[model samples]
Target: MRVGSMIVRPLHHVILAAFSFIMAFPFIWMITSAFKTNDEIWAYPPVLLPDKLLWENISKAWHAAPFDLYVFNSVFVSVCIVLIQTVNSAMMAYALVHMRFPLGRPLLAIILVSYMLPGAATYLPGYIILSNLGLIDTYGGLIISNSVSVFTIFMIYQAFRQIPREVVEAAKIDGAPHRRILWTMVIPLTAPYFVVTGLITFIEMYNNYLWPSLITHNPDLYLVSAGLRSFFIEGGAYGMNWAQVMAASSFTILPLLILFIFAQKFIMKGVSQSYGVNKG
Candidate 1:
């Protein structure tokens, strides 16, 4: 049994390593292709590495479009949305978990059901409302339309439910306000979950394309995803500049990669805690 177990563990690790490489290969190829020439990129043998690194491809891509503005817009909008979602989700989750209300369970049920609905279903109404309010082609339209996220609320609710009722009751008995308990106690305890949710929200907002494209006709208001599409089709001369396109694609995901590298531990911790709470 011991020998069998040892063989199984090694096999499991090898399998996982193979799958990891397989998943990462495309990203690896993109990064490598960024340094390759147009000819090398389309080489029949598929050049895995460049004969000589062309640092100029990155510089050329940067200058090909208003990428700096697009990147700034994406970062600013994504951060703003994450901040707004964090606050609203925390408040809603706190109320749902700690505060007694007549419609609490039903409200939660409704929210969960809404989550089950496809996001595309909201586009028409969202567009009409934003149009009526005259928010189209503006940053406010982008940020305000995504202010409330059902997923963020649900994730925070799950985390908040893991807190001990007795601690909250003690705080209440001591004449502590709900806001005080939430800020000083609950939030600190669930900080990992907040980090996880914030990271997820940021990535989603940053990569969002369809909705932003539908609402904003202004090139300056384009998110990273939309900007990349534009660059690939228009700026890259309809894929004639493959190296520059690869370079642009490579750098666009840099922020997300950096974020994941830093917050990976917190994400893992949050997931484990949430899983334990659900199991309990």
Candidate 2:
């Protein structure tokens, strides 16, 4: 049995290593292609590694578009959505978990059901409403439209539910106000979940393309995703600079990668707790 187990373990390791490399190959290609020359990028056989690192690829991409403004717009929109969604979701989750309102559970059910609705189903209606409000091409338009994320609310609600009811009851018996309990106790208790939700929300908003593309026509209002699309469509020699495009894409994805690496601990904790699987 011990010899068989040893043989299986090595086989398992090899399989996992191969799978990881396969999954990571595109990103590796993207990073490497970002530094390759145009000829190298579209070479007959294609190159896995560049002959020489062309650092100019990055600078050329930066100058090819108004990435500074695009970055600022992306950061601003993502931050706004994250902040607003976190606070709102926390409040809503807290109420549903702790408050005694009759409509609370039904409201939660409705919100969860809404999550099943495809984003395509709501785009037309959302666009009409935003048009009526004259918010098109404005930051408020983008931020306000996405201020509420159903997934964030649901995840936080799950986290809040896992909190022991006895502690909340003790706080209530001690004459603590709902708001006080929520802020001072419940929120702190679920800090890991908040970090996880906020990080996810930031990444989603930053990468969002379709809604921003359809809603905002002004170049100045373009987020990173939208700006990258336009840049690719209208770019250099024969309307394409593959190296620059890859370089910009790499920079665009770097922050999210860094964030995930740094917060993976908290993210895993939050996921486990939300699923009621966290023990000890």
Candidate 3:
């Protein structure tokens, strides 16, 4: 048994190494191409390594548009969405899992049904609602539209259900108020799921493009994804510049990369715990 286990360990490492390379290939190509010259981009059987690195192309991409402002906007919008989604989802989940409100079961069923309807189908209706509220082209429009992430509410509800009723009754016996128990006992028990929800919301908002493109015409308020699209539309003949496009892509993805690198395990572990999977 020990000898067989020793042989399986190296095989597992080899398989994992191959999987890692497969997942990382596209990123490797993008980084290499971002630093490559125009000639290198079109070279047959393209060289992965570029001897003449072009910093100027990246510099031009950085300066050609309002990247600083775009990044700042992206950060602001993503943060707001994360917070709003977390709070709204938590509230809804708590109501579903804890509160015995009228129409509670039907309400959860409705929420689940809403998840079946794709966002694309609701786009026009959502836009009309935003226009009616006079929130178009404003940060309020962005944040409010994403307030309730069904997926998040679903995950958080699972975590909330895992909370033992005995503990809640104990809190009540200790004279802890309802809201106080929710904040202290309930939220503390589900803190890990909350972080996971926040991370997922942040990634979603950071990468969104179509909604921002349609609603906000003002160039200044654009997020990174919309800003990148504008480069191709407004940059004209220079828009075809692969170097600049790749540079913008690299810059846009860098923050997400860094964030996931640091928070990946935490989010994964949290979600797994919520769903009772992959317990460590």
Candidate 4:
């Protein structure tokens, strides 16, 4: 039986490794194609390796659009979203998990249920609201509209719930006010969860295309995803620089990659706790 178990484990590992390679191939191909010329990028059977090794693709991509402004707008808007989302989520989650109040249970349930609500389903309403408020095409619109993420609320609520009530009760016994408990005890204890929430929000906001594209009519305010769409969709005179398109895609995804690498351990811990693997 032990030998059979060993054999099964190795087989599973091999299958998983192959699956991982399949999932990662597009990203690898994107990078390789970015370094190749247009012909090499779309060649039949696809060149697995880049021959040209030209840095020109990156240069062309950078010049093709207002990448710097897009990058700056993204960074500014996403940071605001991360800050607002994490802060609001932590406070709301903490309140729901640790404090008792009327209608609290149902309220928490409603918030969690919002996660299953698709953004596309709400697009028309969201657009109407933003336009009505004169927020259309403005940074104010995007940041305000996407600020409250149900996923962040739900995930952080789980993390917040796992923190022992005993510790909080002890703090209360020591005469810690509600605000003191939240600021000093609860927030400090849940720093890992906060980091996890921020990372998730950053990734989502950075990659968001549809809402931004719909609201933002000006090229100056285009996001990376929206800018890429313009090249791929709009067949103008300079349409479809395949190498440069791939290069821009590579840059668009790089920040998310770096974030995952930096916060890998914390991310794993957060998810494990979310799964009830660790309650404290």
lDDT of 4 by residue, 138-233 (tens): 999989998888888887787777678999999889998978898888878777788888987898899888889888987878887887777655
lDDT of 3 at 112: 93
Give all candidate RMSDs, comma-separated: 1.5, 2.0, 2.0, 2.4
Give TM-scores for every candidate, taking all chains together and pairing residue i with residue i: 0.95, 0.93, 0.93, 0.90
Model 1 Cα displacement at 235 (Å)? 5.6
How big is the positional error of residue 176 in model 3, measured in Å on the Cα after superposition? 1.8
Across 1-280, the per-residue lDDT of candidate 2 in tens digits comes to 9999999999999999999999999999999999998899999887889999999999988887888899889988999999999889999999898999989879989999999999999999999999999998899999999999899999899889878999999999999999999999999999998998899899999999999999999999999998888877654442567888899999988778988899999988878775666555
Q: Could you tell me which 10 consecutive residues in candidate 3 have the lowest summed lDDT? A: 271-280
Superposed Cα deviation of residue 227, candidate 2 (Å) = 0.5
- Report lDDT (Cα) of residue 233, candidate 2: 65
Which structure among the candidates has the greatest lDDT?
1
Number of the predicted model whose TM-score against the real structure is largest: 1
Lowest lDDT block of 10, candidate 1: 230-239
Q: How big is the positional error of residue 189 in model 4, measured in Å on the Cα after superposition? A: 2.3
Q: For candidate 2, list the clashing residue pairs, or say none.
A: none
lDDT of 1 by residue, 1-280 (tens): 9999999999999999999999999999999999999899889978799999999999998988888888899999999999999999999999999999999999999999999999999999999999999999999999999999999999999888888999999999999999999999999999999999999899999999999999998898998889988868755474688888899999888889999999999999988987887787
Worst 10 residues of 4 by lDDT: 231-240
What local distance difference test score does each model get? 0.93, 0.90, 0.84, 0.84
How many Å off is the CA of 169 in candidate 2?
Answer: 0.7
Error of 4 at 134 (Å): 2.2
Please tell me which model should have the higher lDDT, number 1 or number 3: 1
| Candidate 4 deviant stretches above 4 angstroms | 1-12, 275-280
